[model samples]
Target: MKDRHWRTRYRVGAYEVWGTSLDSEERRRNAPHAEPADFGLYLDERWHGEEDARTSHFVYWPTLEAPVERALLIARIKEAAAALRDGATVEVACFGGHGRTGTVLCCLDVILRGTTAREALERIRREYCRYAVGSAGLENFLLNDTGDLVTPEPLRAGEGR
Candidate 1:
């Protein structure tokens, strides 16, 4: 329906992550993935649609508002990362696919790669998009939450424990 904000998939080891925006959903059901992913990992700050709910194992947050819940966000990221390792597809997205989308993608990178937050941010910008993690506040938050290298623990579907 409009210009696409879908981006190339970033891979770490055996898993892959794709970043997208709300507008991109209208034009492609699964342009970035073949035959619709086994599942999705929706990362929109304030947007979730029927398709996402029905087909994705999603996590929601409002990136422009209150800070993201660090523990919960980490759990979700771990879950998605684990799913990816298990041969499932995960698509992380936000309204513009710039800030929140990119931030979460970097988080995934950290968990998967065991890199520092700063390093992940740099990698996201270099390999994904320059506009990624679009706010100083968000950047700071990520740095704080993931200052220590994060090693994501695998989480099962519907299990946040």
Candidate 2:
């Protein structure tokens, strides 16, 4: 909490994904004439802040809980991934940046890397923060609910099912 606003949580493709907490973002916003922080596109997963202009999309996700609307969350994560692929710096965060923030970051990883939810969770924990996906239930939800987020591998020439 010591004036640190953002941290590079992990990478998706060639983009460096950043993470922050609502408190930190508020700090950045309230400071007078602070250079606009390069939080290019925000995938806000906090329970509040629906009116935040910087938020590309807001999901009312509670701390240490699984996303209530899995489909919508996946779609938003896809949008964020698309923005990242197009050279935008994407930031994902919730109230604390460890629970819900980490959950969404895992989903983004699933979509971008075609990895299973469990695999994405492992990578996020290893690369971002060890305490990420902060609870057992959240971990289970990430493992089970994100089955739809995995991108299937494309068949190459002469390959048949």
Candidate 3:
């Protein structure tokens, strides 16, 4: 069997999700016979690569910030869900494989398992990464049913986005 760069793998109901950093895709692409994810969901505003459109998607999301596009986010989440329903292994990734990555994973739980926002957060934290959903704003967004896309107010000044 080939090695997988997945930092975390967990099942939400019948859906199998693999979580990793952007570097994982690069490594997998370079390695001989490394098993690639059937569908890749890349969440980072930094670098966008030319991954196959049929199998990969790149969403522009900043680090430590809640997604500002509600429709887009939900659409991507639905795409992941659909791919999983088709028996495809979906890999969600960000830069560090924690905050944004975790947030999306939790959202998937909400969609796939019908879990509440809190429930999704807890489950992802326990099963995927303890550091998942690293911001209260992101949590609030999810708890609020992932509504409008407004930038959350920073707790203090000089906080980087």
Top candidate on TM-score is 3
What candidate 3 gets wrong by more than 4 Å, as runs, is 1-7, 23-32, 50-54, 147-161
Report the lDDT tens digits of candidate 2 across residue range 1-161.
33233544578656777776666665456534433323433434443433233445676554466766677777777778887777666777666667777887888877777777877888888888877888987898888777776566799999987
Q: Of the pair 1 and 3, which is ahead by TM-score?
A: 3
Ranking by lDDT: 3, 1, 2
Per-candidate TM equals: 0.75, 0.74, 0.76
What is the Cα-based TM-score of model 2? 0.74
Q: For candidate 1, lDDT tens digit of each residue in 16-106?
A: 7867776776436655354455556566634555334225755556664324566666777777788878877777767777777777888
Question: How many clashes does the backbone of model 2 have?
Answer: 0
| Model 3: lowest-lDDT 10 consecutive positions | 45-54
RMSD of 1: 6.7
Q: What is the C-alpha lDDT of each candidate?
A: 0.68, 0.67, 0.71
Worst 10 residues of 1 by lDDT: 45-54
Looking at model 2, residue 142 earns an lDDT score of 87
In terms of lDDT, model 1 sits at 0.68
